[model samples]
Target: MSGADIANVCNEAALTAARHNEEYVKLHDFEQAIERVIAGLEKKTKLLSPDEKKVVAYHEAGHAICGWYLEYADPLLKVSIVPRGQGALGYAQYLPADIFLYTTQKLLDRMTMTLGGRVSEELHFNSVTSGASDDFEKVTGLAQRMVLQCGMSPKIGTISYTIDRGQDMTKPYSERTAKTIDSEIRRIVDECHERCKNLLIEKADQVELVAQELLTKEVITREDMIRLLGKRPFANRNDAFDKYLASKDEKGDD
Candidate 1:
């Protein structure tokens, strides 16, 4: 029979089995059925080099550790040293709960965390790698938002003198002001990078251990992370961001 014909036959048989043995149906039947279909279509993918694997491991571990050190970050779900589809050597996954507004301190905290992986590579490996390309993108994007959109920028004051729609993008600001904004962005990024580097340096030992675990097991869980780092630093205060969310959650005045 064709694959579709076979699947239909299997489904009919499973339905018959389910009617007869509901307990067995509840236990393993549905999962096994899906697994069989998935296994039939699976194909092997590319693997990673030893160095690339280590680089990815440390890079992802850096993100996990930094997030673990922050209060508002979601629980770390998984850390994998497995080579994925897009030549990624390792990756970490987290679910962001909510942050209504990005405050100056919170932005810096996030920037510091985002830069952690690259900084860890430098401190522990004595070199940098292309793995940090995505990280730099994230940090730069956050900095731009802070400077241009958020009014967090003291130089521009609280007033937003943004370019109007359909206006010349280049003509939005004078040549001198444009140069100042560029300089300001660089300065902010440098400061955050330095701060992140310092934080990683203090936790250098943890970085090495986490990377080593990733290399050995190919995955690390949240429990493993907590064992490595005691508690997150910002767990206590909401800053402006948390306050805004709380206000939204609360109903209208009493």
Candidate 2:
């Protein structure tokens, strides 16, 4: 199910590999394309110290472990500490659902995963760092969307409010309702963050093991994850991806 955008990236990566005298574009090229699409190209930052790399490794491992346990989360496909994009010391990639309607639990799972890295840094180092700035931004936006757009808030109760930033319409809700919405969003985010922290603490040993692997190997694939963590017990069992995989298996048998 390669979309036009993914195809474009893979083509670009393939062309670059060809220019470099590679006989064929390997799996590595495709992975680079995906990472590039999502996070821009890998940065050429100065090498991190042993301590810094450990912090990053555990941070990313936190995300992967959280995704592993959350049934509604996208599958944790791969993880790396190759210093991709600006300010990202590491990242975990997941296979997301290709649907518009996001369930409350699913959204909550996403926020939990988003905050997992920062929570990990706190747990391991007893302090936080600026590395989780993007995570915080994403978590806040998602939580706000859950409250304002999706009306997943019990307090808001099915009212979708849009701020008319372009001045096309008045801000959709009254000042009091807006305040309530903001409060609800904060509550949602705080709950998700606390839940994520607790999960990381509960699975501390597994987190440490995954980070140790990342330290040994800077990049790891889905198979590597399966081997390292056995299997994700709570992977979402229903999705279009399941049918797609079944079809592929059928085709391969022919």
Candidate 3:
């Protein structure tokens, strides 16, 4: 978050504390402030039908399960079916690793993780909702960057086709190269989609477990996930987040 964002969160936290009749801004207040900043205000009045709620629960569970099992995807922090923001029916939060560089495999795993929700919808419902639009948008942009800017596409060679955002009508590369780039991007996303489908199928039972829990509770934290699925197989990639979870456990916070 930016400096201004941090300031806004602090201000919001103070207000939240005051609203709760607390003398000091507590950690819970700060957490509520951060959630408001990141996810907009909680929309308790925006009610979903039973069917819609089921879809959302499964969608978010798909995200959590994928991240939990993926070797390089970020660690799952929380998953919720609570309606928030303008259009988000549900969300899964992850603790991203503090690293500057990314590997091709890592990027692929991330894409696969993003695709999990839509794939899960397809597998379970035999259809998909518009909820997956944001996932597709991010996946497409990442795949494009991998092919055009990151040189992760072997078929396209180590070439940078990074376009200037200001120039909307000009092409730095030829029409044929543009076609090749499009094809490469499609290939990358398709492979990731298949990987996600396979993983979700292999762990379908775990997805059901998490989805059912989400339906009952509306939210599930990292500790809840560990209880349901056992410990994550991969080693910790974000020590700070692990430490935070540990502190919460030590305090016996719900």
Specify the highest-TM-score model's number.
3
* lDDT tens digits, residue span 59-130, model 1: 877777777765545556567766554545566755454568766887887887888788878876867888
Model 1: residue 85 alpha-carbon error in angstroms: 2.6
Q: What is the C-alpha lDDT of each candidate?
A: 0.70, 0.84, 0.90
Q: After superposition, how far is residue 205 of candidate 2 from its true place, in Å?
A: 0.8
Estimated TM-score for each candidate: 0.71, 0.88, 0.92
**lDDT digits (tens) for residues 96-163 of candidate 2:** 87768888888899899889898999999967778899889999989888887786889988877866
Which pairs clash in the backbone of model 1? none
Total clashes for model 2: 0
Least well predicted 10-residue stretch by lDDT in candidate 2? 234-243
Which residue runs of candidate 2 sit more than 4 Å off their true CA positions?
A: 1-4, 168-172, 235-249
Q: Report how far off residue 53 is in candidate 3 (Å).
A: 0.4
lDDT of 3 by residue, 1-254 (tens): 78999999999999999999998999989978887888888998999999999999999888888999988888887788999987888888777877699999999999999999999899899678999999999999999999989999998999898787585868889999989999999999999999999999999999999999999999899989999999888664544577786899989965
- Error at 84, model 2, angstroms: 2.1
Full candidate order by TM-score, most accurate first: 3, 2, 1
- Per-residue lDDT of 216 in model 3: 99
Pick the winner on lDDT between candidates 1 and 3: 3
